[model samples]
Target: MNKVKLAEGVYYVGAVDWNLRDFHGYNTPGGVTYNAYLIVDEKVCLIDNVKAPFAGELIERISEIIDPAKIDYVVTNHVEPDHSGSLPVIMAKAPNAKVVLTEQGKSGIMKHYQTNYDFMIVKEGDVLALGRNKLHFLPLPMVHWPDSMATYLDGEQILFSNDAFGQHVCSSMRFDDEVDIDQVIYEAAKYYANILMPFGKLITKALGKTGQLPVRMIAPSHGVVWRKYIPQILAKYEEWSSGLTKDKVIIVYDTMWGSTDQMARRILDGVAAAGVTAKLYKMSVSTRSEIIAEILEAKAILIGSSTINNGMLPTVGGLLLYLKGLRPMNKLGAGFGAYGWGGGAQQNMEELLKAAGVAVQPGLAIKWVPDAAELDRCFQFGLEFGKSVLAANK
Candidate 1:
């Protein structure tokens, strides 16, 4: 890729990952961009690096702007492998460059690579003058990782946000406006839901610092840069951080003999009948990350599964375990399922729901296939749950 200029003295030196389908535990079907930026000033600065495999690509891009040996400062904004995996390669090329990062970042990098390169440890509010522009560092501890930070360029008024406002998508376009706006926004929301939802308060705190800056462009470490819809994305982060949600419900389930499926569908009908929006997903066929994204803005969720070996299905357990760690905010949840003999799925689910920080109530458990009367009762159960959600939201 040729150097895509962000400003007169800055250019995009990142590599797009087109074959990646999963990032950590989350699904990233459209792939993602490991964005790195290079600034040509009195002291040449490289913002971040791509995945280890993309190190050569990054060098090729940097060579387009200036010889890799001309780099003076290599800014490691995040210590995650995707952003810092190429640090060793870059440092090898730029023999005079100092790796500038937070203390925690330095420790992590030292442990990860065991390299004793020249390290410049920076902290929040620290500034480095690059001749025409001054780079300001803002340490954001545990926004996702303790080693994460953002770089702000004073003269250009750009925030090189490492992970905040990032989307897991690889597109030919570099700027937000150049891509499909709706799709970019959707991917951004998914990224927030999956990666940063648990760190909402930390993000809100970080935003307080960033909100005070005079930012003209938000060049994040992933996906396209945000310039045209900065206000829109900031508004979304605000709403999400504040735990805002619409009157939407999600019914996710996995059925062995189709009995639990019947209950979930009836519940969806009740949710619709109660004048609320609802989404239904079968865990056996659905991606857990995608369903979690849907749950991000939902007021409530009704999870179901068929009993096997006196416990909920493995898929349901996996989802519950994932939610427990993510700890989605401000959600009312419950369980419903059908079992053949001794039932345990509903109880198992409710316990995990409580552990996940959801305000869970008693779950509805049915034995064997539902008859007409049982199905009616299931509908009533869903209707009552839906009504309860509406009332709570009000």
Candidate 2:
């Protein structure tokens, strides 16, 4: 628990959990923070709510500073349960609180919670006065969700970014100036890759429109608030929003015996020799979501599977199907594997990649056991593919 005074009466009251591990199945190596702010002015307003389990902690923090009943407004920055799961309980305590949100946000809340509460529907540029401070609503639908909107506090120069520019990172420090920069950036990238990668175009457009606004602090729904390095994060978002990726290769495979795994390792070695970053993930244990995140970031993806009953391995087949549906852009794809009786999985993966509009490289297939000669050929093929990807990018 921590509080940061942005303006005379405006404060950021949020819970930081440096020990958080699992966030909706996506790994949070750096932990996460649930941020909520309180504006104590002529008409008190609370911006966002912590998770339900932490509701008592939030109430205690507010009670220590001011009475909860005195709160006149509750700003539902997002209707997602992580931020709004505790709303019912909080509103029960502050009965006079009017929930401030957009029309879409109101509909989302009712749909998710099955409650009809009084809501003040706001559009872009709409302003609400809180005596000394002013709240301006900016509608940013599909920045990630249809109901997502941001509130900018005029006097404090803080933009209450609901989920945009946020990371699932927990830290004792409340601002970027006080936290480790590299850790925050890595977590931020993971968050974007997992959560916001699909909305790249919308994010680009939103950033362009919001770039003109004067923002001194970025108070996101999750993670520490951005105080000094707002531009740094904004620039990163802009770069990621462009859907640009580095020259890298990912070899994903599932093996019946050790043959397929051996082929994957050779390909990885070739990729490294070609001066590209390469990563390996076995489909047997890796989650599809994690692979999708990597797929969204990598320049080239190599898929491999042993043929089971003249078809691709079940896990690899499912991944190929998932990748096809995602329709990742600007990707060079290839396949590799080993088979005993009938070798077809490698060819099948290549066809799937082609069907999904990926630039397919000539796939490599080997017998049950790849001899030294076959391994050398596969490695050379991988090297050629890596160079081709870099040349294409150039």
Candidate 3:
């Protein structure tokens, strides 16, 4: 993509990854974008860079606006390879430019790249003057990464947030208003659920620190820029960071011999009967990342796994492990499973849920394939769980 001007002097010089399907384990079928910004002023500045393979594309976009050699400052918001993999190449082109990043960012860059470069370490509330424009730095440690930080362009009222308000979406449209609002919000929630869920407290702290800034535009390091819907995205981040959830239930299960699957369907039916929105996902068929996204806003999560060798199915175990790492908060959950002889899957899942900070309730463990009576019991379990979810929401 070519450089598109965001403001009078700020331009988006980034690359879109339309073919990317997976990001670290998160299923990103919609692809993603590596957003970098070029600020043209008395002292030209470049905020963030694209992935290593897209470095050439990033430079090509910048060349359309100004000679890369003219850039005086290159700001590294986060040292994650997706945003900083092309740092060496850009710095090589802009030889005279100084590298400005957080002190932690400095250590990370050196450890990752093992290269020496002119560095200007910055901290929270530090300001850098770019002639008429000023860049205010906000240190956001553990907001996904220890080295992560955001840059606020005082003149344009733009927050160059790296990964904080981003989505893993690749679109020809650059701004939030130009694309489908539902798709944007879904992708944003998915990103937050997968990458930022573990850092809820840190995110809350970051939001509080930058809450007073006059942010009219949010130029994240990925996906579309937020100009018209800044408040909408901010509100979402606030809600998510606070561990707020809706009256929704998610049922994730992995079945063997179709026994557990039968239980899952009946439970889902009961949840619906209780006037609650419930989504069912089979772990072997559905993407865990997508399930995690659903769990983000869901008040209840029900996991089912058929026992195998005195343990839960591999797919269910893997999903629970991934979910545990993401650390979803403020959720009520339970487990259910079918076993031929030994029953341990329900207890295992409940333990995992508790480890993930989810409030665990008594789970059901059925012997072998469930009969009509057992299915009825499953339905009752779902009804009780759904009602409890509704009560918690109220």
Candidate 4:
């Protein structure tokens, strides 16, 4: 894309990664954008950059507005490779421009890049004058990374948040009002569940620290910029960080010989019969990243696996490990499984849920293929769990 103006002096000069399929282990079927902003004033300044491969695209966009060599300052809000990978190239082109970052950001840059570049370090409440506009830096450590911070423009009332309100979506639209609101909200929630769920407390603290600012726009480093629904996104962030959940249930399981699959289906029926919304996902077919997204707001989770050699299925085990690392809060969970000679998969899943700080109930394990009576028992189990979810939510 070309340079798109946001305000009178602010322009978006970023690259869209339309072909990106996966980010780390998180699925990015919708791709993403590496957003950077250029503020043209008496002192021309650039905030953040694209990935290393897209560095030339960013420079080309900047060339449309003004010569890159004329840039007076470059500010890095976060040192993640997606945003800082092109810093070396940018600094080389704008040799006279001063690089501004927080102290931790400096360390991260140095560690990632071999070049020795002097940095103008700023901290919380520090302001850098750029003629008519002033950029205020706020240190938001551990919101995702230690070096993460946000830059607020005094005149425009825009918050250049690095990754806090970002979504993994690639589109031609630049602003929130220009796109489908439902899709944007889904992608935003998915991004938060996959990337920022583990840092809930830190996000809450950061929101508290910066809540008083007059934020008219939130220009993040990914997806579309937020101009129309600033309060809506902020309210969502507040709700998610506070561990608020909905009255829903998520059933995730991996089946063998169709026995566990039968149990899952019967349980899902019972949950619906109890007037509770429930989603069923087979772990072998469903991506763990998507499952994590579903688990984000659901009040209860049910995990199942078939025992093989006295152990849980590998897919279920891997998902448990991944979910544990993300550490989703305010969830009640239980496990169910079908075993041949020995029954240990349900016990293992229950233990993992407990270790991950989920309030877990006693798990149900059936020996061999589930008979009709066993399926009935599974249905009752689901009904009880669904009722408990309603009670807890109330």
Candidate 5:
């Protein structure tokens, strides 16, 4: 709520993730924020705009910091609506301001707004002079989208890092040092796992390019600014981008009569017997987005379902479909299910998980309920699954 100056003339004019309810139908287990920045130089610049609802507040912030008319340039690092939804409104206020972006970025803006505004297109490494400061644009395609780019402000030594190196957190203070480091890191990893895991390799390449630049401040579009802890956050990004993970197991399941849930608990018992960290989540009550976020941190993902008319449970099927499309990185998987008459839901889930890039183990299915022997078998399978996950991490 308060504007804190990070550098002499540069302030964090972004909103915090306060009470943001949901993200893409996924429950925000941790609330999210849409971050925007304002850079004050001889030619005043705004790096990305906030969400539509916060447009008026952002305009007020700009007015408080400097004369709105003095804003000479607007930088669009990403064309995603959450980052650029207020672009039209902001441009209307700063009538003389020139919108700056990459060629793809420019196209994206045109597509989103359907207006042919005069714009300046910069390629990777292209520089624009702003009196004492120089802004360099780096093209980062598919780090989430094709129209994304990162900006480096010369002399200030800050990187306007769009959505990379960002987290979904809300706090009164705006810097990484201001927030609890452990909490920030956890949310950051969860953010990456849900939003950026598909682009891990591209993130690594982007980080490599960023490493070559002189960056003292790392400002992103979604969370706290990284000023003093730049190196530490960058290191964490490199580690996450490297496909690194922990030896943990996630059992995701959906059941009609609690049969599959019983099996899931038995599997956890087996996993604990094997000396592994295992977490259980019900697909009916748990959001798939949160499960995917946890899956990003896990070495193994175990799925279970109940058959409905010879097909997998609807929710489990839907989740598997989503997972297959996301192509999350670095995990093994196993599947199980309970069926009444005739079904291969567990096998179907296993095939889908394997198609989604998970190294799967042999799945187990049961007729009605798991007898003591079957439960014991499920436990043993859980132990084997845990061992498989640990082995993969090695």
Candidate 6:
């Protein structure tokens, strides 16, 4: 394989897992990339490492350019296993390479591996001189992880932005310009919605600190290296980090038989008639990550379910649980559902929605199967909710 260079001496030595289908519980249909860069300056620095299983591939890529033993420093931006799981393998190859990371990162690595190495603890504004080029460290704790940080190469003007701008995409092509921009952006958005949404405040802080850098390229620890779409991605990060939303609504539900399904379709119709972008997802069929991505920019999220055991179905319960953990910002929420006897689905949904910090709006509950009148009422409720979304967004 040809070495992918970010600059004259800096090279991308990452490993791609095209077969990966899921990340923890989040769906990753497009797979993932564990991006690491090898910068062959006077010090010969390796910026990050890939997942442990891909250690050989990462080493092979490094060997193609230079000897692994010559690597003077192995910089870890995050202690996430996917990024640091291969540390032992890489350290074995370069026995003398000093491990570089934040203090918390050092603790994480030690606890994770149950082994210790020569660790260089760094903090914000710390610089690692690598010949003519220097790597500047910015400690951004809890942007996604307590150990998370970003490294900026001064002369090359590339920000190795750890997990901040990452997307879970596996492609042979390395940079944003080489792939379909739309797909990259979509995956990037999904990444943010799932992984970074809860850290909006910290991300805003991360963006503020990194925004001061003269960033010519953003090379993250996952997905494509961003060179052509820096401004677009930065704008999106700013928007998402600021909890901005669009005039769109997302309706997600789990159906027992077909009554709640009917209500969902009718709600979609009403939302469309109200002149707003709307998306519908049957929770049983759709990936939670995908639906969450839609909810990322949506003005409101409407959850529905067929009442089961006087509460929501497991899938609806699961999605709400995940949403509450993520705690998406700047959104309204409502619930609608069908029940044969009791009315607990919508109430439970709204309660979780409130816990997720969503502004609650009045919801709809229909008994048994919806008759024409009840269905119309559902539509009218949707229309009013859509109008409410418009008003709230404005």
TM-score to native of every candidate shown: 0.99, 0.91, 0.98, 0.98, 0.95, 0.98
Error of 5 at 4 (Å): 2.1
Candidate 2 per-residue lDDT, tens place, 80-126, comes to: 88888778887888988889988889998999878887788898878
Lowest lDDT 10-mer window, candidate 6?
385-394
Total clashing pairs in model 3: 0
Candidate 6 lDDT score relative to the true structure: 0.92
* Candidate 3 lowest-lDDT run of ten: 1-10
Q: Locate the minimum summed-lDDT window of 10 residues in model 2.
A: 321-330
Per-residue CA lDDT of candidate 3, range 1-394, in tens? 4458899899999999999998988899999899999999999999999999999999999998999999999999999999999999998999999999999999999998998789999998799999899999998998878899999999999999999999999888899999998899999999999999999989999998779898889999999999988888889999999999999999999988999999999999999989999999999899988999999999999999998887899999998998899899899999998899788888889889998889998988889888999999999999999999999988
List where candidate 1 sits over 4 angstroms from the true fold.
Answer: none
In candidate 1, where is summed lDDT lowest over 10 consecutive residues? Answer: 1-10
After superposition, the stretches of candidate 4 with alpha carbons farther than 4 Å from their true spots are none
Q: For candidate 6, write residues 1-394 as lDDT tens digits.
A: 7789899899999888999998999899899999999999889999889998999999999999999999999999999989998999999999998999999999999999998999999999899899999999999998889999999999999999989889998888998999999999999999999999999999998888998889999999999999989999999999998999999999999998899999999998898889888998998889999999999888899999999998999999999999999999989889999999788888899999999999998889999999999999988988888898889877
Residues 1-394 of candidate 5: C-alpha lDDT, one tens digit per residue: 4777878767777665567768776567567777777778777988898888888888888888987778888899889888998888888888888889888889899999997766988888799888788889998999989989999988889898988988888887788888898888877777787788888899999998999998888888887888878878888888778877788898999998877888999999989887889999998888877788788767888999998877788899888888887787787888898899888797789889988999887888888988889888888889888877767766
lDDT of each: 0.92, 0.84, 0.92, 0.91, 0.84, 0.92
The CA lDDT at 356 in model 6 is 95
CA shift at 84, candidate 2, in angstroms? Answer: 0.5
Q: Output the lDDT of residue 67, model 4.
A: 96
**Whole-model alpha-carbon lDDT for candidate 4:** 0.91
Give the count of colliding residue pairs in each prediction.
0, 0, 0, 0, 0, 0
What's model 5's overall lDDT? 0.84
Pairs with steric clashes in candidate 3: none
